[model samples]
Target: MFVPFLIMLREGLEAALIVSLIASYLKRTQRGRWIGVMWIGVLLAAALCLGLGIFINETTGEFPQKEQELFEGIVAVIAVVILTWMVFLDAQSVAQRQSTTGAGSR
Candidate 1:
């Protein structure tokens, strides 16, 4: 339960970051008029996702409780593994950056 929430939080943050960057670029380029179109695109994408989710939920309504629990467990495990891997990679990169900066200072 907590793992799924964390995964959703991370994904939501990433999507927000991407959207903000694009909006900033559009404003800087004086193409702010297209911002409306961008927003429309965003709305359409969101709607599509919602619809897809509903369809999938309805389709899986007949799934056995045992199977659903197993699937959820598998997903949680995968999410944890992926999150751990990302943290490891991020730590490595940060360490490398610090070492390079330290060497430059020396």
Candidate 2:
């Protein structure tokens, strides 16, 4: 329960960060009027996602155990792959910075 909550919290924060950056860009470009429209779109998207999740949960109750397990396993594998990719990208960036700064010469 806590794990899902934390994951959702992180996802929400990431989305908010992106929205903030976009909003700032729009404001900087003097396109502030569209910010309201962008926010409405975001809200609509959130509602759609919520509805889809509820629909899936309500419908999946009748699915067989094997299929449900397979779905969970697939989700877990995808999550692991994405996280591994992020970690590798971060490590590569750090190595590149160190090399440029001559900190890795030693």
Tens-digit lDDT track of model 1 for 1-106: 9998997898677557556656765674467999999999989988998998799888875568898889878977885676566556555655675686664421
All candidates' TM-scores?
0.54, 0.57
Pull out the clashing pairs in model 1: none
Question: Model 1 segments beyond 4 Å from truth?
Answer: 61-106
lDDT by residue for model 2 (1-106), tens: 9998997897777667567756765674568999999999999989999998899889874568898789778976876676566556555655776777777532
Best candidate according to TM-score: 2
- Which candidate's lDDT is highest? 2
Model 2 residue 41 CA deviation (Å) reads 0.4
Native-to-model Cα distance after best TM-score fit, residue 78 in candidate 1, in Å:
16
lDDT of 2 at 92: 69
lDDT of 1 at 26: 69
